[model samples]
Target chain A: MSLAPSERPGTHPDDSNLSATYALVLVVEVIVILGLYWIGRQFG
Target chain B: MQWIDWAIVAVYLFWIVWTGLRMGRKTEELESYFLANRSLPWWAVGLSVMATQLSAITLVGTTGQGYNAGLSFIQFYFGLPLAMIILSLTVVPLFRRANIYTAYEYLERRFDSKTRLFTSLLFLLSRAMATGVVIAAPSVILSVIFGWNLTLTILAFGIPTIFYTMKGGVQAVTWADVKQMVVIVGGLSAAAVALIMGLPDDVTVGAALRTAGAVGKMQALDFTFDTSTTYTFWSGLIGGLFLSMSYFGCDQSQVQRYLTAKSVDEARGSLLMSAFWKIPLQVLVLMVGVLMFVFFLFNQGPILFKNTYLPAVQSSTRAAEYAGLDREYAQAFENRKLAARAMAAAQADGAPAGAASFARSEFVRNDTAVREVRAKATALVKDVTGDPDYNDTNYVFPTFVTEHLPVGLVGLIIAAIFAAAMSTIAAELSSLATSSVIDIYRRHLKPEADDAHYVTVSKWATLFWGLFACFVATFAAEMGSLIEAVNVLGSYFYGSILGVFILALGVKRANGDGAFVGLIAGMSAVWWVDQHTATVYLWLNVVGAVVVTVVGTIVSLLTGGATAGPDAGKSAATRAA
Candidate 1:
């Protein structure tokens, strides 16, 4: 029997939102780096 | 420092210690002392996470990096947000669910006791030494600004921290960290505002940044794939990722922060908070450095940012030569100032990027001349002082704060520096004590000790590490740039430790034997790579982690891997491994 993701955390078998959150973080990082690159190109 | 400034600093110091002592009253038991009985709020834990990682070096050393090298250093943390996200998914939940005091405890349960002892011992060594560098960063730099003796300053920073952390425990340290984190952000915000305000009347913020861009201070990203380059998009994204994983996932100092949260989700929540804010916060920090560069472009910045060496140079035989360089520096400063103003004017007049190219090149050229003059003066100081390794990078921000900011603000920024140093020292001290008592003292020295006895041992452990860190600080002050000094020290050990955790969690056929041998191999490989190649320090983390996983796996397969016990290889994510 697997422990419920809410009460007991384990392998990310139940929560797809957690993956979304991780993906969101990566997306945000990409955007931030792109923004920084733009700043360099604009002025640097 | 003005009387009001001193008053503000004095009040801040006294208030923090008093608050820490009061909150630490409930830490009578081992769990409560070390983990606050796992009852802390996510926001508070989140703030504590930031407080521990963002040290005095962030203020004193990173700002100098911004001023000296520009935004290139920002790439070093490019992997941080992702690392936090990955950790929230893995260790934040794993360590919390496992109900472990130290991350190493899980290693023993998953692998063997030897792996647990060895990993924890490595943490104790790495963190204790890194803590000393953290303590050294602010005290040595601030001593010059405050004109206080280095030893006294080290004490002033270390003792209050040691006293409260010893008595109040992690609970006290965490609560104090929340308040200190606020002061740090507030001070940085204030410094940012004052820096913009200090720009010359003719130079707008946009104009100033454009001028900064001309000299490459505004460039925040480099696409270079060179392994020799320290901070690049690739190095930061890949190399920094491994380093961050090792630090937050495997290192006890960070694991302990999230473990204080009420549940697994809350622990992940705390790390997510860092994920969202860490990069933007770093941007603000580097911008402050860049703005200081712009601020100095028009204003008359000293030839030497450090005032401490002035006396020695004045008394030496090269004093006359130093005076001549000083005169040349003034002219170079004027040339650079005029070029900066012209660049700003061109931007204000709506010149296109292509049209303003000449002005930018002129500014860059003049800036180089200014650097040459300053370098000559610095050599004179080094020659006369007989301190061949003298560096003024850490002094740049502190000296600027004292020399430039309004009176009360100076005190606030200094207090922020104090906050940065004390918060880190408190966390490390508290974590050091936890690892010592939980892993070594109780586990080995006296396996049957009660809570009260262990708590007493923990306090003495905190005291011992505190004084040891203070002693290390005196010598660590001159190793190099305080920021890089701490990170380089960590990079040497962080990757290998992370590799061990990977073996236990991800590699199913890996046993304690594999983990142990893999750890030694990883560390030795990191050392070998560092000695043999110019592959930059960030990439060393990658080398260490990869080498360990590969070596551990081969050994584990050869030894027929441990597949017997119910708890064997039972990691949080792969519980049946």
Candidate 2:
């Protein structure tokens, strides 16, 4: 018998919504890293 | 170390082991043992995911990388968040819907048992070999710091980790990992803060950064189109993406982490957690090392951080020569300190660009002379020890921890190091046992075993792999060349393994025969590139996955596609004859 998926704590949104959010998250992170790089270059 | 520090470490170990054992008491079936009944919350699994990736070497070594070479090393993780998003959309839901115990089990449903067994064996072999290095790495620090026997050190780390993982299974491993993540992060955060506060009064935070920036330590981006550079933006994004994809998508250790989450959404959330926090976390750890670099400028830093060869240098025929070099190093260090102070003052004044520029060049000249003296000392020590590549990057953080950090904090950081080591080893041991049972024993050795029987066998598998890791680690201490060979050989297989997964997921035309052949071709291509070209190692993953998919798809098309749908073969039930 397959173990049933337990009820989630409702903390996370659905996968479709979360997937898009994560994609956005990655884009934001890349920007942050780039910002850090530019700032480091300026101070450097 | 002080008694207070020893007390903190001892208490932490006791609590961690007890908590792990307590969590495992209810794990009576394979589902509970391996997947935590798919009932774990997203946050627990998320922290475990982070903890598993933040191994001891990463904690110590990456910080050392920050100290030695600036934040350019952070680029190595540029692909990680992207990889996580891809896995979230693709493999996370795919594995959840299939309801498989191991990732290779899904390969069997899509391909054939031979494909399943071949890939699983690769996982077992590579992971088992890598686990040895994982345990050996921190044990080296313990041995040096505590003056303990290396074999005993191996056992000290391996034995408790083995027992808890063997008894508690994934539940124990996951919970222990969550707690470990806390300690690891807390210790690192505390260390970073302390290092900043510990800096001399004259060197303001901005000044320290300017000092670091002036030395090219803070330069994080390199936009050069050169393929030969190790940590370029392109290499990190492309190469790191491929490596992260294979690791998160295909490798059972990581696959198993997300699989334990309550639902596909939670699994994706766990990975997303890593994606969001990983770069910033890396920057913080690297910042600690950068701050340490500034701390050493004003303080009298060691000429050679690894002091193992001090007695030998003092007693050797070249003792006076070493002493003269030490005196020269002191003079250069003082000159560099004055130059650094001048540069910091000039930068604050907004004076003509040439003043700061001159101070920077003067500081650099003195710094280069000091490094030259240290290089000569390193060579002399290497000659005395007869180990050619005796660099001390790994020793730098531990040396700093002992010498500088306050008493209770030192113990806390040391415990965090142990936590990092245990968390990784636990996850590895858990996944190794899972693959061994789900992919091999149940599929081949005994397909009809009852739940109790399989669970018992799973425990035995965990114990066996744990012992095996310890065995390899013991020998690894004696044979350095073998460890290198094992690491190189492991890298050779990852791209091929990742390739087969890509075929399984993306290429509908791929049959068992095509995938099997494509895997071999991919391995061959990677080996060929490694032997013939100067292509950086990160690119090998991309090449391997692409070669497998292209070759496998071509072969499948040439052989005529889709004779059957999903149930392509049932010979997986039969043993190889």
Candidate 3:
């Protein structure tokens, strides 16, 4: 059987978008964590 | 435990069984059974992955770790995100593209059958034994709390899981895991909230945290560069990264989680989800433990958390000694609580010299008492159980749940613990069955078998492994601290397996012979280091991976390359004949 389309050897079709999305998620995660830390410090 | 608790647990079991039975129709074919037809969404796959890793032991034992040892353990997951990002870029895509049922199947194509077989066998040995321990951990806790036989407890958890897994396969495993994750997370959150409410009125969340911080429980980051220390920031970042990579990248249990993703991007996303959430999740679990520690400060808790061991001590000749030690422990805790309160008050009102000195003296005395009781408990356990290494770490959360949690919530928390255990057990059994059927049985014994035949065999394999895990669980009591047992087992083989995978991808010249020899050598070296060196076990993953790659590459260079092609040709010819 042939391999799945997304598993093919060429560059991923959504590589750029995926990377950008992932980067954004990472940034947002960090910001949220920092925000929580700040909040903990203030109210804590 | 009340009727409501039993009802909740009963309902949970019924729902799980029903979910499994529902997936039976979809599991008629091998592909559907093993890979869910590679048609899962990223979110489901992601949750399954997390559920598989965050077992019941983690919920109970990790919180206990936080309560006892502090937050330094959180550093152990520091490298997880990096490992996930790296794997997403590398092995994940390759495995998806190859459309291989097992990771070892790719090894045969890239190197030789022998290399594939060796690595797969190593995986089976480790995962099977580890799965048994996973089953045992929750079983022991349940048995202790409910006064059931441990062996019966093991079967109680193991049997239903086997039936569901055998009936529904990957589809059942994944969806069941989703429900299990919900129970686990919900239960933990509920427990945390209940704990906070149960605390004395003066013990606000902030005050609890401050107390925990004063006792070093809140020290999440330790920048010390000690290779010998297991949970330092540097060790965690470097060693933890290697361990996570080996676990997620090479271990079939985790690989199977991502393999079911709908696309390469989805698989990467699923892994990234784990990477992002693991540390924070661990932090939350540890925080629960820290809260529990603070709760104890305000309340009188058992001098020895292991009540089972306590009774054993009372029955022993050292009963008086134990009783005396218990009194000392009580006094010490009282003093410590006073010190902790003083420290909290001091910190609140700007630390005064007198308050600081009082807190310091109390802290020292309380710590001494804690150690003294622990020593007595350890000695008593050795006398009773005939094992000196028996530690009370695993008992910490279970004791809290049984003693403190309200009736209905206790049942939910217990169900949650079962969810954790079953989730990990299901994933491990599924992967074990997949590796056995795909890598060995299907490829060698019956290459021309239809999907139905393969499906039947897969179900049987799942059942077989489940039984094997149950049997192993019987002996798991001898193993100390379920968390440490799992990690030690992983370290024994993970590095070498990861090394072989690296060799497969990076060094084209590394033929099967080289890979095979290098793998053995890598494992041997890891064993040697474990025996002779003082390095933390987690770092062994790094050492093993590096050694396997370096040694495999060298062996490949020494032996002329391309032996794998001829080897596969011979195997094909033998099959044809």
In the range B1-577, model 3's lDDT, one tens digit per residue, is 8899999999999998788778656777777899998889888899999999998889888998988877778778878887887788888887876666888877777787888888899899889988988888888877876799888899989999998988889889999999998999899899889888986765567766766665566666667887777788788878888889989999999999888888788888899888778877887798788888878887777876766776666788888877887787788778777776765666555666587557645665676676677677677667776766666677778888888888899889989998998889999999999999988898789888788888988889999999999998888854666546666767979988989988877776787888898898888898899989898888898888898998888888898864544224333224222
Q: Compared with the true structure, what per-residue lDDT tens digits does model 1 show for residues B1-577?
A: 8999989999999989998999899988988999999999989999999999999988788989988888889899988888898777677766777677898877767777888899999899888888888888787777777778998898999999999999999999999999999999999999999999998888899888888887788888888799999899899999999988988898888889998998777788889888888888898998989988888888897898887788878888888998999899999999999998888777765577664778878888999999999888888888888777777777778878988999899999989999989999999999999898888887678978678888898999999999999988887865655546666767878899999888877787888788889999998998888889999998999999999999999998888885433344344445411
Global lDDT scores for all candidate models? 0.85, 0.83, 0.80
**Per-residue lDDT over B260-339 for candidate 2, one digit per residue giving the tens place of the 0 to 100 score:** 99988889899989888888889988888888888778877778876767887788888888888889889888988888
Of the pair 1 and 3, which is ahead by TM-score? 1
Q: What residue runs in model 3 are displaced by over 4 Å at the alpha carbon?
A: A1-10, A13-17, A21-44, B349-368, B380-385, B478-487, B562-577
lDDT per residue for candidate 2 within A1-44, as digits (tens), equals 01112111122244557746876886888687878778686768
DockQ of predictions, in order shown: 0.38, 0.24, 0.19
What TM-score against the true fold does each predicted structure earn? 0.94, 0.94, 0.92
* Clash pairs detected, candidate 1: none
Candidate 1's DockQ = 0.38
Model 3 error, position B266 (Å): 1.2
Model 3: TM-score for chain B:
0.94
Provide the TM-score of chain A alone for each candidate, in the order shown: 0.63, 0.60, 0.62
lDDT of 1 at A25: 79
